[model samples]
Target chain A: MSGDLTARSGGLTLPRIGDRALWSFVGRRIGHAVLVLFCVATVSFFLVRISGDPVRQMLPPDATAAQETALRAQLGLDQPLLGQYVSYMTGLLHLDLGQSLFFHRPAFDVIAERLPATVTLAAGALVVVLVVAIPAGVVSALRRGTATDTTVMAAVLVGQSAPAFFVGILLILVFAVNLQMLPASGMGGIENLVLPAVTLGLYSIAMVARLLRSSLVDVLGEDYIRTARAKGLTGWRIVTAHGLRNASLPVVTVVGLEIGNLLGGAILTEQVFAWPGVGRLTVEAVTYRDYPLMQATVMFLATVFVVVNLLVDLSYAALDPRVRLS
Target chain B: MPVLEVNDLHAEFRLDTGTVRAVNGVSFSVEPGQTLAVVGESGSGKTATALSILRLHPTPPCVYTGGEIVAGGRDLLTLPEREMRQVRGNEIAMIFQDPMTSLNPVKTVGAQIVESLRRHRSLPRGEARARAVEALREVGIAHPEARAGQYPHQLSGGMRQRVMIAMALACRPKLLIADEPTTALDVTVQAQIMELMADLQDRFGMAIVLITHDLGVVAQVADKVLVMYAGRPVEAAGADDLFERPRMPYTRALLESMPRPDVPGGAVLDPIRGAPPNLLDLPSGCAFHPRCGFARPECASTVPALEEKAPGHAAACVLTDDDLPGTSEGRRVSGT
Candidate 1:
């Protein structure tokens, strides 16, 4: 113990990635990831089944018994419940999501075709959120209990309470209908991206700004911040370099979850804008009663959420040294 | 002339709930190469007084109502923030009490120290790093370079304190305000840290303002001691005289309350009676009168101004010359 202590005191080094500790962490994450997959599958299976009859939806209105039976057998839908579940799990392990019921294409291909659009839209919105929210949060916190501060906080409150769909409609009414300055909605080009991005990002801006402001308020009162001030670092320097940097963890944590939410819930905005995205594809599947398509889309969204949350957890160790990695 | 002179300083905080008189018309000074220990429990305005020197107190919430904090021949209260920045860390540096939370946990200890050095002096990063290592070594951190890379939580409580001391001394400030620097550590670590501070102070020839509630620490490091009660100075004297003959009742009570190691384990420790008065609803006359066994009728009517009871000892109590009995008499009065 004494020797180990002396060695540790002398110098510290990062542990090897392949070490037991690292492997254990990875193993734990993998276990959690498996559980998440199981949950997604269970929920998706029940949700799609309860939506309507997959068999009737897949078949034509005039199809005969032999034709229906042959189609069911071909799709493995004729299998017993346990057999179907095992087959689905096996397909998942092999990264094979079979053909979409509505699109008449592989589910993987359908999701792949639409994922980039959702990712791009969500990423754009997140960038807008950070660019707008961070400075606003810092400035508001710095100018606490003043007119400017009040104005900023009121804006945040309004943004938080206002729905994204309503904001999207308002943006369209102003930008597209009245001013004719930009496209009302869609993910066609940079010109079309502005309104929807802002609409999707507005609530995030409000949430992140509020979070950051409160975080900065608490952090600025900390002894280290006092020490920084005592060192004669200017107010701007203190806010930007110290206060905001420390306050960003909560913001970062929420950003990941928000991004997942945006990706999943961008259906309304996508519909309003006619953006060719996964959210729109999911909605189309729901309307058509496409069980395979809906299952595949939902499963993908769940995976994104789980992966994002995992990344956020990993970032906790990155942002705060006090969080013991071991 | 004193290196630092605070004359009748009054700092108040207009909290949303109500106004809190943190430092109510208190004053003290520290000469060059001397240690003045401002001893008080939490919320007794000791920390506020230190903050007022740098004008670090946030406005609106913390208002410096009246008085002069003249340090390095300039009134700190009136200095422009830009110039005050130059004075802070360059002339007057502060070490906070909680080492665990004092240093930025995200940044390496070296980065924080070097940041202070870089801000004050136009040193290259390499030179700044060297100075940081030297400062760390001065604070008795073994393998300073290696320790510098490690984060605050990686280090022990004592080590983090050394980092704080290193950071405080990095700029080579004329006065170092150590606000309860060793209060969070274990006894042995506290002794080690105290010794380190004293050793560094001697080497640097910097005056220290040691703000603490520990009388033991006050005895060890202070050249002069300022005892505060309810946001007011109860006693101020040379260290030896204050310890030998604590003039004020509050000081006497505080001294009596400390558990001495020399005393046997079975000896019942005497804690001071009554909690510290709420600053908002402080006692009418002397704040300590409620807790002071030696309170006279006059103590409840008129506030006692801090007056010289002896050549160097000043106490804020109405006790007459003979009322403060001799050491033997004091023991008899306490029935020791």
Candidate 2:
């Protein structure tokens, strides 16, 4: 311990990325993936069952009796509940999610096609969030109790309290309707993406920024900042290199949850903007009661949320050396 | 010439509740290559005095009501922020207690050191990194290269403190304020840290302000000792003189409380009878009167300012100057 405190007090060395640790990390992630899939399947199974009479909703109102009977038989909706559950579970095991009652297409096929669009929109929104949030959080923390800190925190408060949809409309009124700077709503192209992404991402930006600001403020008061300052590190280096990184662990969870939420929506923004995405498809499926299609889409989203949460957990250990996965 | 001079230093903390007079009218000086140990308990204002030198206290909450802190022939109290920033890590560095929390957990120890190097000196990343590794080696870290890549949490409590010291000394500051630097470490580690600090001071010829509550540490590291009580300096003398013949009753009480290594089973851990006086509502006259065994009616009414009891020695006590020093001053023995 005596030698430990004095040794390596000053030193810089290139990091050797651990090959062994990488393999173990991947193995753990695989385990998490399996668990998330199981959880998603279990939840979707119950939800799909609880939703009332898909066959009645699917059949045309003026259909003949024979045609109605044929459609129920084809969907296996005519079977007993236990038999249907067994059939559904069996189909789930084979990864055959069945056909959409309304779309007349394989449920998995439609979901797969729409996944990339949601991924793109969510990623863009995440990028926007990081670009604005991280620096604002860091600066606010470093300049705590000052004018900048007050303004940033107040802005975050307003952003958090105001509904995203309302804020989105407000933004459209300003940037789209009045200024004519950006499109109102849509993921038509890269240019059309700005409004929706910003509208959807703004709330997350506020949450992450505030979370980061408070955490960083607490960290700045820590003895290490004092030690770093004592070492002649300027405010910028201390805030960015030392303060921000340490404060980001808590912010990671908020970011992950927001990513899941944005992926779930932005469909409204997408529909309003004519952006072709999973959220738009999910909304359409829900309206038409396309049983298999809605189930697959909802399950896929649940899976994504679970996976993102797992990733956040892994990052906690990455950001903080004190955290170790058991 | 003295490397640091503090004259009539007064610091007050203006919290939401009330203003706390942390450091009140204290004065001391330290010659180059010497260590001045300011000994006091928590809330005794030793740290406030150290911070006042750099004007590091946050405003509205902490106000240096009055003082002149001259370091290296310049009044530090009035230096501009930019100049003060330059002086802080370059001229006068500090190592705080709780080394575990004092280092940025996210940054690699090496990077933190390099930051100090780059800011104070014009050096590219590679050169700075190289010096950082060399400094780590100098500080006695094993596998300096490997350890440099590790973050603060990667290292143990002791290792972090070493990093702190390395960073503080990276610029070779003229004065090093080690505020309870070893208080958080274990006994064995404390000894090693002290030896390392002494060695570094000898090599660099830097003046040191060793603020600690531990008298044992004072005996080991301090050239001169200033014992503070209720935000005031109660005694100041050469370490040898103060240890040999403590004039102030508080100093005597403090020495008695320390467990001596020489005595088998040690002196009966004679605790000072009462708590330190409240800064907001301090006792009239001598603040030590409440706790002092020798307190009299005269001691309560009249304040005793620090006065020379011998060459290069001063203590704040009216009895020290009395002609009839030993008799009927009614020395209340312990446990009475």
Candidate 3:
């Protein structure tokens, strides 16, 4: 039995696909991501232009035609549409997003300053999602048809149907006003982070938990799980070491898309919670017709969406050898 | 003493429709170093009987109505889940039909083997890893070190079954319940796996409860044979004796169904005309009577007991002892 124990044909060939092959896959994905981002930037520029002129919206109500004209020229809103498109595209090439009309700073700078806040909000919401979803999904799958599973399913249903903004207000009314436990609004320490994170993550948490529960439940019934049991693995090991990794594939895919969904929906959530984030800034820029800031926000979110999906695909390859084969 | 003794094992599925008595009063045993083949068609409770030994049946749906699966001096039926865990991989290991679906797709074959070894033996991590590779080699998998590092999809069907055998036998359990282990492989690969299993049994002195419908497999490896029909054993005897003189009509039909070289070129293969009776609502008497060619009026009203018609040879049919084929009238086995 111990004879012919030598490794086959030289160096490591075990990882399904090698580093160069994986990197090449990533390179192709990056190429696709650039194309998607470029399309979003172009579409946003035209789409935002059709929302009406920022100059007209910013002018005084009783102002004369000449005053409106002067403001338009000063803001470069008077330039021809294609000329404006050229300048915007040129600015993007140099990593410059034009001046924010209201902030009177570079549009990139305005969005960048708020990036940390949005990042923290997204990170906290994700942490909340995983913390809540993992145990809920796993327990529900393991204890299927039990009261605990039914209760979790019911709770997840309520969470799925409740809008983020509505959830945020209800949380504010209960936790902040009634209990006097947490701050009602604005950003600060750990205390301020909890409600907004929960509110923003509510729908995603529901989605992830539901998907995970179903996925895990399906995986637990697989032939290998019975094999695991026959091997004397009980309780946690069978569920975790044998089951969860396979179950997480669908959840991982959903999470990537949900994070993109989370950011888009963060606009309403930030409005309800009064938490300053790029989402809130994007709303502000839209209200005042700040085109550059609007374009910048679109670019930021589009970039985030693209990068997240790329990571998810890469993770799919890493998690399942079947995926790597294709 | 026998390594595994299953007595009057009864198991049922409690579904919305009704209770399904999958295994009803099925009894068999296997001495150490022996192989007992449970032969039956699909849904004949062969798989259920095999699963009952390890208490691996799905519980919400499956309830062990009655049984004693004795292994290593303990009734596995009454043992708590915690103690059952020790008995499972440590005393009796099992392998399934499809090697493709029987492994964790996300895990390497070696890691899966290492997991069971560590679980049962509490081997140190490095030692477990080394044994895992050796186990792969023992199963006749070429380049064991390289194959160990590869995932299930990376290996062929035969290679994966070898890996499964390695995993099941790594701890050298007293009994191994192989449920149609060769059913999913190529014809040539099937022979190779069967040979590998027989060789391993010789080396380890492990008993086997091999559940299969293929009579060819039973004829090749079984020391003893038990034929089941609708969850009840209809015949039990030494393998050679059962083939030579199958007293039960169902067993006779099963034997006749096999394609043999001895049969002439123009001779057609016999197929038992009807389906096996449903477990949920089995026919009143002998479950196979509806399908039996020689079935009589009494066969429908009376369930024949599996009594020993000869020393160590039992059959459930009500045919008289003197009803030999050449001397018989209409009740002969070859009448079909």
Candidate 4:
């Protein structure tokens, strides 16, 4: 009987695909991400051009036709739409995003200068989300239906519903105006990053906590958890080793997506706090019709979004072996 | 002395609608190096009885109203949870029904086994890994070295079950509670796993409390049988005795229900008429009265205590030996 069972089950054995397949899988995902970025850039480039003319917005109302034409010629705006598009693509091929109309510098260089500030804020916000949300979510799940769970969930609900701008102002008023422990606006010391990061991260924290709580709560009820308990594992070990790893798969995906959201949505928080990040630069470029700067910033954000999603997919595959990249 | 003795165990589930008496006045003992099969249909409290021994049920919904689970002379029901942790997986290990869901998907089968070893034995990582591989090999897994690194999804149902058994027996636990371990596998696989378990039992010299609904499984692996009906053991007897001379009506009905290959073609299989009684609203007196073919007027109003019909075979029923159909004619009489 044992021999028959083994012989039959041997046919059901999974073929062990080697590391080469894993590498190819990652490579294929990267290729897909790049293709998505190209589509984003193409759509945004034409869409932004159709909205209005940057030359008109940059020039004074009293300018003569000659001056306008010369300015347009110099900015290469006088060229046909197809001609302009061709040049834009050519410039992109050479890693050039054209010169900014407002800053009178290369659009890439202008955006690059502000990139660090946005990255810092996003990174800080991610830290806050991880440090605060994971523990809160785990506790809420472990102590499900208790007073602690109720209180934490209620707080998360409020945090998720509240607007970023509203939260930013509130934090400034309390931590900046009332107590004066930290600066309300600008980028300088670690204290300066606190308000904006918290304001921007509050929603993400809430989202992560909610997602993790539900995922973990569901995981805790799984048969494996009971098995873990039956194995004489301590409650803490079972939760951390067995439960948390499975629960973290969804959380990782959410956090990766949230990074893109944090970068794009940082515009409002940056404006409120006067943090000179790419988000604020993008807004300024739009107001002044600095087409190159605006296009470059939006494109940069799109690339980041696609790349983050790719990373999330890779991490997800790593966490769950059942997820085949193919 | 018995390796584990469960005395008058009363377990309930406190639900919003009402209390459910999942296991009521259940008592049994598993002696060293012996196999005690607790057989019952679904919702008959076999699982509840098994889990209650380890205190594995979630607290809010499940509560042990009364019982004494004496294992190694300590009452497990009243033992501190901290100490209970020591007994579980160390003194008395358990393997559940579905091997697919019972093992953690994220963890390697090797790591899982190693974890139990390290926890109980305090073995270092290097030694634990070696022992984990040895355990996998002992369960007849091919390529124990490579298999240890693979996740649960990589293994077939039979192999996964073997891994589960490997983990359970890795610590050399005195009493192993297997709750329908072969129910999730194919017929051939079930036979293989059962054979593997019996082999492991001989080598380890550990008592096994095999909880399953399959009479065939009980007949093959069990030395003694405790037939449960509606959260109570209706009959307790040596395996051959129970099969040869089933005293309780429910037990007789169960035996007749088994599909016999010897029966001529086109003959219909005899199945129990009604479902097991709902734990929340069980009938007064004998819970099987509604379904018992030999149910007497007294059976409906007064419960029959499990009493010795012979020297060691006990059954709970209102019928006497004269009232029961003889062993040779039992199947035909019950079917009609």
lDDT on C-alpha atoms for all candidate structures: 0.82, 0.79, 0.86, 0.88
Winning candidate number (DockQ)? 3
Per-residue lDDT of model 3, residues B1-336, tens digit only: 989888999999999999998888988889999999999999998998999899999897999999798888889999999999998878999999999999988787878888888998899877888999899989998788878777788889999999999999999999999999999999989989999999999998999999999888888899999999888999999987787788898888887776665445313577898887778899988899899888999999999999999999999989965663642122122211
Q: For residues A111-225, could you state the per-residue lDDT of candidate 4 as single tens digits?
A: 8899999999999999999998999999999999999999998998898889888999999999999999999899999999999998899889889998999999999999999
TM-score of each candidate structure, all chains considered together: 0.92, 0.90, 0.95, 0.95
User: What DockQ results do all the predictions give, each relative to the true complex?
Assistant: 0.41, 0.40, 0.48, 0.40
lDDT tens string, model 4, B1-336? Answer: 999999999999999989998888998998999999999899999999999999999998999999799998899999998999999899999999999999988777888898899999999877888898899999999988888877788899999999999999999999999999999999999999999999999999999999999888888888999999888889999987888888998888887787766556314668999888888888999999999888888888998998899989999988999998676353332110
Q: Arrange candidates by lDDT, highest first: which order? A: 4, 3, 1, 2
Q: What docking tier does model 2 reach? A: acceptable
Error of 3 at A122 (Å): 1.0
Per-residue lDDT of candidate 1, residues B165-250 (tens digit): 89888888889998888888998899898999888988999999999998877887889999888788888999877877888878
Instruction: Tell me the tens digit of each residue's lDDT in model 2 across B1-336.
Output: 998999989889887777788888999999999999999877788988887777767676888888799887788888876677888888999988898788776667887788888889878888888888788877778888787777777787777788888888888888999989999998889888998899999999999999999888888778899999888898999987777778888888887777755565455587899887777788898988989988888888998988898999998898754632443121212211
The fraction of reference A/B contacts recovered in model 4 reads 0.54
The window of 10 residues in a row where model 3 chain B has the poorest summed lDDT is B327-336
Give lDDT tens digits, candidate 2, residues A119-234: 88888888988998888887788688899999988887787677666877888899889999888765567877787777667778888898998998888777777776666566
In model 2, the runs with Cα more than 4 Å from the true position are A1-22, A142-151, A173-181, A271-274, B264-266, B321-336
